[model samples]
Target chain A: MKPLTTEEIRAVIAAGKLRDNLFKATGVFCLALALIVIVALVADMVIKGSDRFTLDFFLNFASRRATQAGILSAWVGSLLVMLVTAMAAVPLGVAAGLYLEEYAKRNWLTNLIEINITNLAAVPSIVYGLLALGIFVYQFGLGQSILSAGLTLALLILPIIIVATREAIRAIPAMIREGSMAVGATRWQTCRYHIVPYAMPGILTGVIIGLARAIGETAPIITIGALTFIAFLPPAPLSTLGDGSTAGLFDWVMAPFTVMPIQIFNWTSRPDPAFEVNAAAAGFVLMAMVLSMNAVAIFLRYKMRKNIKW
Target chain B: MQIHDNPTLKAEARNLNFFYGEAKALKNINMPIYDKKVTALIGPSGCGKSTYLRSFNRMHDLYPGNRYEGEIRFFPDNTNLLAAEVDPIEVRMRIGMVFQKPNPFPKSIFENVAYGLRVRGENNKRVLDDKVEHALKGAAIWDEVKDRLADLASNLSGGQQQRLCIARALATDPELLLFDEPTSALDPIATGAIEELIHELKKRVTILIVTHNMQQAARVSDYTAYMFLGEMVEFGKTDEIFIKPKDKRTEDYITGRMG
Candidate 1:
């Protein structure tokens, strides 16, 4: 075969560069498209709800008049639910992930469990609500309370946390584990001293992402029968109840609640145009909550990962 | 196998065989490790030198489907390390290892050295400080890191990180120390430093090191075993093996004729 002339080689190089530039431009366009959509949605919400963005909008309870309604009960309920979700899921998911990654043998049963966990992450969120309804609500006699909603969200995010934990643990080199064990450290000792600490940053990211998803989960919260208009907050710990009895520390967990999604859902469906503005404002607040949670994840991950290296 | 001094046996591998699932990695092998002496295993890649070294501390047990047949007798107690009832962790406790790459935990320098002692449940601050200092001094890295024990270990140079790993292994005061190509990842200066440290370390602990570098085996080891294709080709004093190898394959491998 004859060697290519200089012009021919130049043309070939130019063609390759053209393809590269095309792919680069396409990638940038796709990314920009996603960013623009999210930005537009947030801007639209903020603009439409500007009138209802006052301090009273957050201080007052849900009222008959849309202008007077506030997210006082809704925000509190969302925070409380998230607290329970994190408490339940972090330990459970992290422990399960550690076991599966570090301890479990490569057998059929473990393989089965592994496949199921990955599949569970893709299951509809509403299924978890139904499961929580049966197990936590009726079977455990927990009713439609904060405990039920939190546990339901916990179940929803468990698979995500488990997968993330596994990925993080796997990222740790085998030599580290061997180094720990070679010092006469037991399996538990290695896990406690090395594995858990190293995997913490990743696990924290997963937990926050899961909670962010759970915060905006309207279907599950609604399916589990959350109240849309809660006038009163859950009784504070050690505070005297209406019946003259002091509330227990965990009394809030069992109290009826209204989360942001349910409140937003209720307002959007109302007949009055004023209620639409309430929904828009509440949506922005909820979006801000999710975005702030993500920011915390990124910051914490950066801080914790600063010292870690292979 | 022959030794001019007839040193006391620290550990003995008797007819040992190792399997990684269905594949036999190490054939029947019998070798003796002298008390407080450095023994080096020299071989090419896929020759199972590292495999033989890992067997001393039951390092293979960490992974599933890996099996050990025959006994690796630990001296004094005569415990069969490869026995079914013998816990790998217990074996590991009595022995320590340093890998090819430096693997300091994502922790402070002090914590990295004190990790072994901590695993043994030594939590008192004074005790940890003293032991960590001693270990670091023993590994010949105390001067470089003594003032900054609180600094993260990963921030150190590659050679310094390796010495920190040595300090970590030394902290536990194990009877046997295994080095699997520990200096392979280091530069010439760092390699020289590690070689000198290894020479100094054998006074307190028995050493078994696997190396791809023939000169390293000759420099640091009192006794050298040449391995090829999962088998021990020859074992003798380092001087005798280097000067006049008994096996043809050992001679060829040493003379750079073949791997």
Candidate 2:
């Protein structure tokens, strides 16, 4: 075939540029659409709940009067349940991930385990609640308390943390491992000195993402029998009780709890329109909590990754 | 084997064979590594030069299903390095390695060199400082990094990083050191610096190096072994091998008629 003239070449180039511009426009439009929807939802919540943004709104307990209804118990329970979830999941997930990546042999058994773990991440969160209800609440007889709800959320996020850990570990170059081993260091030495530190940023990101997801998990929390009208907070770990007796350090974990999402769900289902305002305010608060967790994840990742390079 | 000037044997491979999960990579081979001398293995890609070099420290044991037959006998103790009961970690403790690319840990320069000693449970600060300094000086990179040992190792240039890796290997005072094309990723000036460092290093430690460059073998090694398709084609004094190779394949490879 004969070569094309300069004009024909220019025409072809123009067509390709047009297509590229069209694709760029399409991507920008899609991004803008998502951003607009999120912004609108946040704006609506803020405007509807503007009257209830006082300091008293955060300090009061659930009352029959809408003006007196507050999220004191709801926020505290959410915080405590998240504390349990993080404590339970981080160690178990990180250890399992480290073992799978650095120690386990490549065989059919390992392959089966890997596949099952991936599948577990996609399983419904409510299923974990049901399992916790059977094992933690009934069989283990922990009661429908903060411990059961926390344990349920931990189960729901375990797969996320594990998968994240594996990916973070895998990102480290093989040469680094080989370099450490060549210096007469054993397997455990290599992991402790190099692998764990290098992969810390990625692991932190995964942990925060998992916690963010668990914070808004209403289905699992409700299924595990969280109360919707709790007036008192879980017992302070070392504070004096109303009857003047000292509370146990671990007493808070066993107290019946109500989280932010459960309170919102209860308010939205009420007959009075005033309760709807409470739901909007609580929803915004939950969104802020999740966003702040994500921000912390991003900051930690940046700080940790500052020194590492390929 | 041809006669030499009665060099001391630091280690020897006796009927050594290696297999990567059923496919034989190194055939039966026997070669002696002389104490305090540099030995270079020269071959084309996929010719098992690296496989042979890695066997000295049992680097292959890190992966599953890679099997070793016969023995790599270590000197002074006559330990069979490839034996089932012999820990690869113990073998590696006496032998160190540098890879093709510079791989400094994401840590302070001092910590990078202090790592091997730390693994051996050396925790005293003064002892670590002296050893790390000596290693950096031995690798010929002390003056440039003396003030910034606290800085991250990854901040250095590629050549500096490579020399830091050498210091890392040298901090433990191994009996033998392995270089797997350590300067292949470097510029000509950096390569020359590494070659000079290797000449100085041979006074204290036995060295085994694998190289794709023929001229590198001629410049740095006292003895040379030519490998092709997992077999030792020739082994002799470096001058003899470069000037007049014994095997037809070795001659062809040296003359650039074949790979």
Which residue runs of candidate 1 sit more than 4 Å off their true CA positions? B1-4
RMSD of each: 1.6, 1.6
Q: How accurate is candidate 2 locally (lDDT)?
A: 0.94
Clashing pairs in 1: none
Residue lDDT tens for model 1, B1-259 = 2344878999998998999999998999889989989999998899999999999898898898899898899997999999989888898888989999999998999999999998888999999999999999999999999899999999999999999999999998989999999998999999999999998998899999999999999989999999999998899899999999999999999999997
Writing each residue's lDDT as its tens digit, candidate 2 over B10-123 gives: 999899999999999999988999989999999889999999999988889988899999998999888998999999999999999999999999999999999999999999
Model 2, which residues run further than 4 Å from truth? B1-4
lDDT of 2 by residue, A8-124 (tens): 999999999999999999999999999999999999999998888988889988889998999999999999999999999999999899999999999999999999999999999
Q: Per-prediction TM-score, please?
A: 0.98, 0.98
- Model 1 residue A34 CA deviation (Å) reads 1.7
